[model samples]
Target chain A: MKIGIIGAGAVGSILARELNKLPENEFQLTVMARTARNGFTVLEDGIKIFHDIPVHDILSVKDTFDVLFIATKTPALLTLKETIKNMTHGNSEIIYALNGVGYDDMFVQGIPSVVYVSGQQHDEYIEHFVNQKIILPDQSFTYLDRLIQIIENDESIHFDLVKDKHFEQVRYEKLLINVGINSVTALSKNTAKIFEDDSMVRLTRTLLKESIDIVNKNSQTVYISPDFIDYAMEMYMSYPREMGTSMYYDVMANRTTEYQYIQGFVYNLKTDDHPPTPVLDTVVTLLSGYEKL
Target chain B: MKIGIIGAGAVGSILARELNKLPENEFQLTVMARTARNGFTVLEDGIKIFHDIPVHDILSVKDTFDVLFIATKTPALLTLKETIKNMTHGNSEIIYALNGVGYDDMFVQGIPSVVYVSGQQHDEYIEHFVNQKIILPDQSFTYLDRLIQIIENDESIHFDLVKDKHFEQVRYEKLLINVGINSVTALSKNTAKIFEDDSMVRLTRTLLKESIDIVNKNSQTVYISPDFIDYAMEMYMSYPREMGTSMYYDVMANRTTEYQYIQGFVYNLKTDDHPPTPVLDTVVTLLSGYEKL
Candidate 1:
């Protein structure tokens, strides 16, 4: 099976690295990147873990792949739209391994996957802080089994094929986590240690509760427990004190953030009946303001 | 009249400079500062404006004055409590020219004055951004008229003697302004230009409205119009694009912020019936967390 990963960001590069470790006879893996670089390196601890997988600029790729993974941030989807359109054949299955939800309909028969990984890329080297597992809904798709087989073969990477019934709930749980952690750390310019503060802990819980409320109201099938608020807070507080979210690093580097798909996505979900989320609204506003600068 | 200014910071230094310009025989002014520097310089538009006033270390101060002004930040009060007690006679009137409200009762016969000036000190030179009038309540005090007369004599500084009945209202108004602008700019690490963003503008108005609601509920004598929300937003947005608040600068430099008296004061006022102020609570928490660092 021919496999291609679009957008060689931290997530894309990490996925490419994990897939390259699979049996070459069964999976021919290639990475379509924005840059012209043929390969990327990832740093774990003090050692450099380099991946020499074949990489082509998205625009230069002409061959169709059996399976394609869209790993770019939501904002980059627009620029890659044409490239994606040209590279995917009628039989190709596209999986969006990104932070947001509700983008599955944006692409032709796209499968949205909740990525439970965190990393930052500096030039060609990516520094990964968290690499838990990727969760995908177990739905009827022609290439689902082959995709899972290739991913599951890698010992370093974890994959979970959750039942379709509980997919939305799992996706929202991850989204709510991102919404709270990313927004606060990004705005405060602090790290996970910020959650150690009592008031910050409360604020994080409140933000999570708001996001969960919206998700629960929008999806009748998924119900997020109020206790998940405390769970998320404890999870963030458990991370390294200096561990920063992607949004925090983006703001520090003055790059456009993934806020549009995270906090902004949550903000757009609010309706007349939904309770107002001032904290989330404030974070989105401040982040949007920071982007303008 | 003999007058001594305790806590020779930007406000104290400016007050000393303004008071030194008065007739020498009518008023004698001494500045008690943390440092032993005899005087400080204030730069306006790159020009050196030196203030050559007598300065004394707070611990070494011995003389009692007819009227005293406490101009240091709230955090500095603990170190200077003994000095303040030693410098004020039984008839001496003490005025706290600082940020935050409800501190008047903390000092022996302390009069809280709302200072509408804004500036930042770089080494010995302070940069004046906004030098609006200082508003004080007109009440029965031994040296109230003399204090106003001396302040009125300075053409560069403006003073307002509002009715004593509405003193808390005026003070709360200033507090609300700081609560909104200081917390947002400080946390966002952006300047007043952040207010230019529509979402940020809305957030600022919402924060101001929350503060006004609290103030209006606490004090029946003072009614802040809902329109004041727009007025405050416009006022902050009108500042120079690159201008930063003291709290913003404090966070940028890793100095202790005035959040305790500003947002913390407002937070302490919360009761069971009062509406929740997650925004203020978050700011105070984050700032408190920053201070720990």
Candidate 2:
């Protein structure tokens, strides 16, 4: 099957290398690269591993693929609207491995993954620190089944392609996690180790609680219980103390962040009856100020 | 006449050097320092000029001075209550060259100065960037007359000791300036260069406006006209973009900031009729989170 991945970020690089391990007949993968480099490097376990994959300029791509993964950062995800059409057929299923939510409406056949892959794309190298899992919708689909079969049959592929039925719940949980971890990490400009500070924990938890209050205010959609705050904090603790979230890396690098889709997504859903989100509003304003118009 | 300056920071160091230049018979200056060093190096105009002054520990301040200058940071200013008694007599005048407001209650004879000194204390060098004026309370005091005459008579002294009659207006203006620039510079971990960014301007201006509204709500005491917003913005623009505020330097150096006396002073005065301060609350929370409880 012919497959295409648009972004060369952490998740995109991981997906490209893992799927490249499959038999050539089953997976013909191509990573679009606007940069001149033909290969990428990943630093794992204190060692540098280089992957040689066919890189094509995304804009120059004229060939269509059977499956596509939209692994770009949330801010750049929309630019692929027209370019994606040139890379996929009408039946092609797009799998999105992104952090923020509510962008699924952009594509009808798109499946948003819980993007279990954790890493950061530094200037010269991508650091793969944790799980190589991408949790997809448990519901059966032809392209997803084929991709899962290809990965499951390969014992060498160190990736868990989780097809979970509770994808929605876990996705919202990931959103809450981003809302808590990303905001503090980016604003404080610290790593996961910031949680070691009690004030950091309290401030982050307060932000998380504000976000939780907003989502759980009504049962219309995306309901997260109050207990999820603990779960989210625990998840934060589980991360390597040195590891940085995508937002943290983005801010440190002086680039725009994914706050629009992560914090902005939750904050924009405000209503008259919603509890006042002072922390969220302040965070959003700061983030917006950091992001240039 | 004997004089004691408590802090060795930017303001303290500058005051010590300027006062030291006065004739020995006219002015005897001593800088109290716990750190084992008899001299300070000030980087003026790219050259390191060393000022060797007698350094005495504050706890060992057995000699009383005719005039005392409290140039310590706002947080550490209150710690000198007992030690100050050893350094001053009933007739000795206390001059405070610090930022923020409402610390007058800490001293019975404390004459707050709208300090015009601009400099930053780096690791081992103090960078004197701008004016060395110290604005004293425009009121009649005994020592004030002697100090002003001493400074005015010396042509070698580059410091402008301005005893403005409109000192109250300028002091409040300085507080508003800190409310706008210090908060944004500290929270953003940026220098005055951030004002070049329109979003930074908007965010900083918004913070200043919130502070203005609160101070103007009940004009029983300190009243600042709305026009001060433009004046504050002009001050931000007038600053060298490369220069960092005191709070910015503190946060960058991982030390506690002056938000408690600056932003916190403005925030803690909230009344029932006060306008909601979501931005102020968020800035305070983030700053408090940065500061250890």
Candidate 3:
């Protein structure tokens, strides 16, 4: 099966390197960027790991693919929807590995996956800082099985997505996690080091509670536990102190942020039945102000 | 009458120049900083206004004043308690022209005043931006009367203090304004330009409403109108777009901020009768985190 990845950013670069572990003949991998480049380098624990994946410019693509991964920042995802649709046939399986939610609806055959892979990209290098876990909702896919068969045969790549029957619960859990870590880190413009401050941790828990209240009100999504707030706080403490979240890096670099789809998405879901989310609303306002600025 | 100014920052420098408007021989004025400086230059509307006021080293100060003005930033006020007390005699009238509230109780003769002068000092110059109006509580002072009489003679310095019939209302109004503008500007690292964005104005109103809720619950203070939020928003729009608040400049320069006495002063005033201030509470957390970072 021919595989194609659309971006070569931090997450997409890691995706490319992990996919290279698959057997060469069965998987024809093609990584795409705006301009064709040699490869990407990722730094883990201050050590360099280079991936020499073949990259193609999106403007010059000639052949269609059997499976495609839409790997881009949340702001860049919607613009690539028609291009992604044009590159795949009816049998192609497209997986969206993004930081925020609410972009999958733009695609007809879009398979929204809860991407757990986290890292930051800088000039000439990307920093790999977190787990390489991708989860897909348990559903049928036509050509993806062939790609899964080859991955299952070798199984060297630990970043491949697998089916999960309880994806609804997991999806909300990931959203809640981002709502906590991403909002604070981005707004503070600090790394996970901010978690060391006890008041910072308390603030994160407050934001999580506000998000949890909104998710519980939505019947369409699974309800998350209040205990998850404590668990997520623990997870934040587990990260390397100097590491930055994707949103944090975005703000530091003065790029577009994914706040709208993460915090703003949950905020827009509030009905009259749901309690008001004053903290979340204020954060969203500040984030919007930053974007315009 | 002997007069002393404790700081040489934006407010203090402006105070020296404004006081220079009075005849030189009547009021023996001295400006203090860590080291002696020649003078300061203020940039108003891209024009330079030089104040050739002589500056003295605070360590080498020798004279006790009949009246002294503490014009330092809020963070620098507490540490100068001993130095300030030493510089004043028993009959001295010490005035604190600070940005935030709750600093007067440190001294028995500490007379708190609401100063409306606003500016940001850069490398070698200060930018004056707002009105130089000072409002003092309606209370009698011994040496303060002669100094007021001196000001009433020349009547040239526009920044001198005058007694107010309802000083509590003005004090709380100034606190609420700081709670709104200073918090947003320091956190966003932007200037009054942020008010141009409608969402930012709305966010400011939300914070003001939160602060007003707490002040109304305190029986010791007068209740502020909810309509003051709108008035404050209108006032923010009138500032120069490039102008920044003192707290904003402090954060930009990585100096200690005045949050402890501004938002923090209001947060600590909360009683059981007050409603929860989730937005203000979250903002305080972020500002505290920035202080630690």
Highest lDDT scorer: 3
Error of 1 at A280 (Å): 4.0
Per-candidate TM-score against the hidden true structure: 0.80, 0.74, 0.89
- DockQ each: 0.40, 0.25, 0.49
Model 3 residue A145 CA deviation in Å: 2.5
C-alpha lDDT of residue A188 in model 3: 71
| Backbone clashes in model 3, listed as residue pairs | none
The residue-by-residue lDDT of candidate 3 on B1-293, one tens digit each, is: 78898888777887788777766677788999877988889887789887889889997998999888888877877788889888888888888888788877888888888988877777878887767767888888887777676666765666666888889899889988989998888777678888888878877887898899888887475979889988998888888787788777776676888899999999988987677788798888888876765
Off by over 4 Å in 3: A34-37, A54-64, A82-90, A155-158, A190-203, B34-36, B54-57, B60-63, B188-203, B240-243, B252-254
Query: What are the clashing pairs of model 2?
Result: none
Q: What ranking emerges by TM-score with the best candidate at the front?
A: 3, 1, 2
Scored by TM-score, the top model is 3
Q: Mind giving the per-residue lDDT tens digits that candidate 2 earns over A1-293?
A: 88888888788899888888878876778888666467889999899988887667788778888889888888777877888876777788898888898788787778788887788787888898887888987788777797788689879987788788778778888888899988887776667887787757777788999988877774365678888888889999888787788887887787888888899998977888786776787677667656643
- Candidates 2 and 3: which is better by TM-score? 3
Selected candidate, larger lDDT, 2 vs 3: 3
iRMSD for every model: 1.7, 3.5, 1.6
Highest DockQ: which candidate? Answer: 3
